[model samples]
Target: MVTGGAGFIGANLVRALGEVPQVSEVVIVDDLSTGLLDNLDGLPARLFQGSVLDPDLLDDALAGAASVVHLGALGSVPRSIDQPLQSHHANATGTLMVLEAARRHGVRQVILSSSSSVYGANPVLPRQEGLRPVPVSPYAVSKLAAEAYAVAYSACYGLPVLPFRFFNVFGPRQAAHHAYAAVLPRFVTAALAGEPLRVHGDGRQTRDFTFVGSVTSVIVDAIVRRVTTTDVVNLAFGARISLLDLIAELEDILSRPLPVVHEPPRPGDVRDSQADCSRLRELFPSVRPVALRSGLEQTVSWMSGHVLTGH
Candidate 1:
C-alpha cells in the first residue's frame, strides 16, 4: 500500500509496481488535495480516497496490506512558513497516525519519506543521516518530527521502518503550475513557454537532484527483498549541480538558449543541499540513477504534451 499514491512520485511508484512479478496487488490512499485523480487515471492500483490523518480510513486501508509507504505530506517550505500548524498536522501528526495504523495491522515494512530539508541550518556539506539536524523552517521541523516519530516507533514498538531523507527528486508528472513548484519542473515549464527561467537568489545554489525512476526502483527492490533498516538513508547520489548548470543542460537538451530572471531569495531556504549516498549504495547496490540530462529530457517531453504553458 502507498499513501499519497496519486501524487508525482507515488503515481510513478504505482506504475513501476505494476511491472513486478512478485507484486500481486497495489493499493493507494490519498486525499485529492494536491494529488490529482488524473495522475492515477487508468492505473491498476486500488484507491482509498482520504487523508492519512483519518484514522478510520487508515484502519480500512491498512487491513490485509503487506506494507505501507508513507509519502502523504503537505510539502512546501514557504507554505509551511505561512501555515505551520496545518503543515505540522498533515505531515508530522499524519505520519504518527499512519505509523499507529501500520503497527496495529502488523505491517511488515513501513517505509517513510522524509526530506533533506530536515538538515536545514546545519551548514553541513553533503548531508549524512548521522549529522544532527538544525531545522530552520517550520516545514523542516515538521518533517523532522515525522521522521523522528518513525524512528521512535521502530525502537519502541519494534516496527520495521526505514526513514529516507530525499534530496531534490524530480522527473515526469512532477507538478509545476503551483507557486511552490520544484525548481526543475518550474524551469522546464517556463523554458517550454519561452519565458525567462526564474532563478531564486543567485543561480549558484546547488542541489543533488535524483530522478524519480531511480527512487522508485529502490523502493520496488526494497519491497521485493523485504529490506528494512532502522537507520535513516540518503536517497540521492553524490552529484551536485548548480541552478545555472542545470539551465545550461536544459538549453543543450532544447538546442536553444533560454532567458533568465533573478528573484530575491525566499525565507527559510537552504543555501545548498547534497546527499551522501554511501549508505544507500550499500543497501541497494544494483540501482543506477538516471543522469540529470536524460531525466530532464524525459521531463521536457512529458511536460510539453501534458502541461499547457503560457496558456
Candidate 2:
C-alpha cells in the first residue's frame, strides 16, 4: 500500500512499483489535498480516496498488505509556518495513525518519507543521520517527530521501519503553480513561459537535488528486499548546487537567458543543504543518483511539453 500515492514522489513510486516482478497489486490511499487524481492516470492501482487520519480507511487499506509506504503529509515549510496546526495534524499525527494502522494489520515493513528540512540550520557540511536534528519550521518539526514515532514503533512493536531523509527532490509531475511548489519546478515553469525566475534572498542557497526516479528506485528496492533493519538514511546525490548556478544551468538548457526577480528570504528557509549518502550506498549498493544537468534536461523537456499543452 502506497499512502499519498497520487502525489509527486508517490505517483512516480506507483509507476516504478508496477514494474517489479514480485509485486502483484498496488493499493493507493490519498486525500487528494495536494495530490491530483490525474497523476495516477492509467496506472494499475486500487485508489482509495481518504486521509490517513481516518482509522477505518487506514484499516481497510492495510488489509492483506505486506508493506506500507507512508508519504502522506502536509509538505511545505512556508505553508507549515502559516498553518502549524494543520501541518502537525497531517505530518506528525498522520504518521502516528499510519504506524498504528500498520502495527494492527501486521504489516511487515513501513517506509517513511522524511525530509532534509529536519536538519534545519545545523551548519553540518553533509547531513548524516547521526547529527542532531534542529528543525527550524513546523514542517521540519513534524517530520522529525514522525521519524521519532517510526523509531519508537519499530523498537516497541518489532515492526521494521525505514525512514529516508530526502533532500530537494524534483522531476516530472511535480506541480509548479501551487503556492508551495518546489524551487526547480517553479523556475522551469516560469522560464519556459519567458517570465522572471523568482529568487528568494541572494540566490546563494545551495541544495542537494535528487531526481524522483532515483528516489523511487531506492523505495522499490527497500520494499522488494524487505529490509528488516530500522534505520534512517539520507537519499541524495551528495552534490550541492547553488540556486544561482541552478538558474544558469537552466538558462543553458533552455538556450536563452532567464530574467530574475529577487525576493526577501522566507522564514524557516535553510541556507545550505547537502547529504551524506554513504549509508544509502551501504544499504543499496546498486543505487546511483541521476546527474543534476541530466535530470534538469529531462525536467525541462517535460515542463516544456506541459507548457505547450497548457496544463
TM-score of each: 0.98, 0.98
**Considering summed lDDT, which 10 consecutive residues are worst modelled in model 2?**
302-311
Model 2 lDDT, residue 205, Cα: 94
Candidate of highest TM-score:
2
The 10-residue segment with the lowest total lDDT in model 1? 302-311
Q: Which residue pairs clash in candidate 2?
A: none
Cα-based lDDT at residue 236, candidate 2: 90
**lDDT by residue for model 1 (1-311), tens:** 89999998999999999999999899999997878898998899999999998999998888899889999988889989999999999999999999999999999999999999999988888898899999989999999999999989999999999888888899989988997788899999999899999998999999999999999999999999988998999999988999999999999999999999999999988999988999999999999889888888898889998887422
Which candidate leads the pack in lDDT? Answer: 2
Candidate 1: regions farther than 4 A off: 309-311
* Candidate 2 residue spans exceeding 4 A from truth: 307-310
